[model samples]
Target: MAEVYQRLAEHLDRLPDGFAPSEDGAEIRLLKRLFTPEEAELAVHLTLDREEVGAIAARASLPEEEAKERLEEMAGKGLIFSAETEGGKVLYQAAPFVIGIYEFQVNRLSDGFLQDLNDYWSTVKERKEPKTINQLRTIPINESIDSRLEVLPYENVYALVEAHDRFAVAPCICRSRAKKLGKGCDAPIDTCLVFGDFADYYVRTGKGRHISKEEAKELLVKADEANLVLNPTNSMLVSAICCCCGCCCGILKSLKYASKPSEAVASSFIVEYDEPKCVGCLKCVERCQMEAVTADVGGVRLDKDRCIGCGLCVSTCPTGALNLVRKPDRGEKLPETFFDTWRAIAKQRDAA
Candidate 1:
């Protein structure tokens, strides 16, 4: 049984966003926590690409009815992915451990499960193939950008949400896990917002509730006011938005330890401070989740590399000294649609 899960872990490691193997066998244990022996065997045959049950069963060499039942059951448990198409055909697929299956377990995650996941995460530092597409990217607070710079629809949180008719909110899984480990902060827990097909998956799987577009915009404002980092999907179509904090978000916390944190995720802007207007009040320093701001000899200095262009510091500046400028090199190119972005990443993985 244990060997089955070990095989399952190895299978997951081959996906686009890999589940790298661990020396301590923690990966296998994490798999066991999420999958039964039979489930592990079945899951090993699945792929990250979505397919109808007949196709999935053909790949697994099982009857369509039998595979459909098991796959639907796994989807119900938040262990696999399932979705209904425009034509009403059901599709099943495997999902990565993080940013996928683990996130889907928002409503039902156990403390023990989180501990095992954290342990597994701690061990997975090195990998053979780096991801071509960042799982998340920083989006500036819509209201905090400099009035002069032209903000794109994708860069504005409210504009992105307005494009989606269906919306859903789930607990911030990182904060939930941190709370379980007694390392969490008072930052709001239920601020993860999803849209379109992603939103449908969350609500259909019973992990989240449907929310109005107005409610979604309000949540974005509330999160910005709370000094949370706004991270959305790395695509322009904006399938999801995560209200993150430095204290609990895996992405933000990891940036603190990264040798070159700026390269860890994509950002369209960087902070620029006006020295003459600076008061050294240190409000920006307090609000900056990236540790990019600090008191300098004359005023506050901004670490352009450390700043992810979240605009939280701009909102906190009483002196009106800080503003976000478009990062010309990286900001110029963005995928026009979510699927276009995903396909680009998939192509890189295939080439590798």
Candidate 2:
């Protein structure tokens, strides 16, 4: 059983997000908690691409019916990824640890599981490697951008919402984990949004409820009002958007440790402060998740490097002292779609 889990860990480590081994073997412990020996063995044979039941069964050397049942069970347990086509054909695939397995466990977390994850993440943080691709990218709220500036379709939160037909709202996994540990904020818990096929999967697995496009837009507005940062999957074809808070979100909290949060995140814009129009109300200071705005003797100070261009400060500023501007050197173009994003990450990891 332990050997099977070890093999599964190595398989996951090869993924783009990476399930790195730890000195304490916490990663293996996490896998033990999540997968049975049989499931782990089957998972090792799976690839990133989705496959039909017969194809997967042949690859695993299992009977077609047995493989189908096992795949369905693993998918329900959030141990792997599965999708049903319009013609009612089912497909199964491997999922990475971060954006896939961990996020899928939103509705099924326990105290023991949380502790194991924390232990694993502690080592992961120390051994972090520089990557060219981020799984998620930051985008300012609709009200934060200047009307005159040209915002790409992917950069516009409203446009992204409008592009999707199907939507689902799920509990923010980070906030759920925080609340379970008794250390989260008062922000709304059900702010995570999934779209299209991801939405179908979430709804099928009972992790989230189906919501209409209008409802999704309304939720985005509410999240904005609550001062949550909007981070969507880093692809032109958005699949999900996480409305995150600094107190609970792992990505936002990691920014606190970064010397330059702006450079650490993928964002097209940065906050530009107009010193002359400033007021001492300190609204921006309270709204900033990155701690980029602080009270100063004159008014409030804006730290450009610390900002992630969330636009929370700009949306609520009394005197319009803050505005978002496009970065002069916005790096490489975003991946065309979600699969493309992961493919690029996998290629980069392979080269590294």
Candidate 3:
């Protein structure tokens, strides 16, 4: 075990400074509880790719069988993903929460850069604000995309059109058991789409891409025409990539990471739960992977202002017992600049 920890520390040291180890006091306790010293060491050495496993094992001086066995234990505890690959290969990736160091980056960046990028974002947001699941006048997800609408619905689930970056057009491909699932966990979101002043910088510098806000809106309109249920303002607020859940959406690879909160929902819809309507069928409780929902005397209780408005609870309510309502009061439902996405470029220039 000491050898494992020593080698693991060496592996951690080799990772780029950006990769944060899971060391929160609480997370530390959880890791201690969930993984053995060897497994924990292996967790520190893992990445999303399968090809890196052998190198990590060689670095640790452990036999491939030993490293592989330790990882399997972590997967059982949901600490890492060591799912099987069809070609007799083992696919290893960090579990979502363990992988959330990336989200922490976004959350951190949003705080400082959000204002600097606001002028351009403010306009892009206008087109996205009041993003409704059901637009008043729109197309349906069933018949759009020509006749490619098979068991899966849109280009998102359909492999051909999904890109990690819309403008840069990076192939954010997820592999399947047959074609090979991208991301491995099968998240419906091939990648989260981002649009802002910096997003354009991403494209030009190969840092990211400059996808016009209007063009994004057009994509949504096309999605609407296809009858795909699109989240309003979500592209602007949380991510540009529209996640397709299998149970919830045809994409976001819902089936892959449904059990893990970190890999599953990027942002949750915070809402209020009317216990009177909840029958304690645990429908909402069951659907809420976040454990944000709890049982009250009446039935289920919701923590408002914290919900990401996923509407999953409502969708699961056989009796419509749960509802994910809009939070206009908390987050300022309007951006105060609707229909100005076209001019976002000018805003960024002035900021620069």
Better of 1 and 2 by TM-score: 2
Candidate 3 residue-wise lDDT, 275-324, digit = tens: 55666777566555345576777687665433444444555566655544
Measured by TM-score, how close is model 2 to the native structure?
0.97
Candidate number achieving the greatest lDDT relative to the actual structure: 2
lDDT of 3 at 109: 35
Report the C-alpha lDDT of model 2 over 1-352, residue by residue, as the tens digit. Answer: 6899999999998887788888789998899899988999899988888899899899889999999999999998898888899999989888888888999999889888999999898875364566879989999988889999998998999898888889999999999999999899999999999998889999998899999999999999999999899999999989899999998998899887899998889888999889899968998988999999999988988889999999999999988899999988755788877767877888888888
- The parts of candidate 3 lying over 4 Å away from their true place are 1-24, 98-352
For each candidate, the alpha-carbon lDDT, in order, equals 0.81, 0.90, 0.38
lDDT of 1 by residue, 1-352 (tens): 7888878877776654667887798888888888888788889888767888888788778898888888888998888878789999888877766567878877777877887887888887686576547767898877898778888787888888988899999889888877877888888888999998888888888888899998999999999988999988877788789999998887788777776576666787888989999988888988998888888897888778787888998887888899888876753466765545555665677788
TM-score of each: 0.93, 0.97, 0.30
Candidate 1: lDDT over CA atoms? 0.81
- Tell me how far the alpha carbon of residue 290 in candidate 1 is from the true structure, in angstroms, after superposition: 0.9
Candidate scoring better on lDDT of 2 and 3? 2
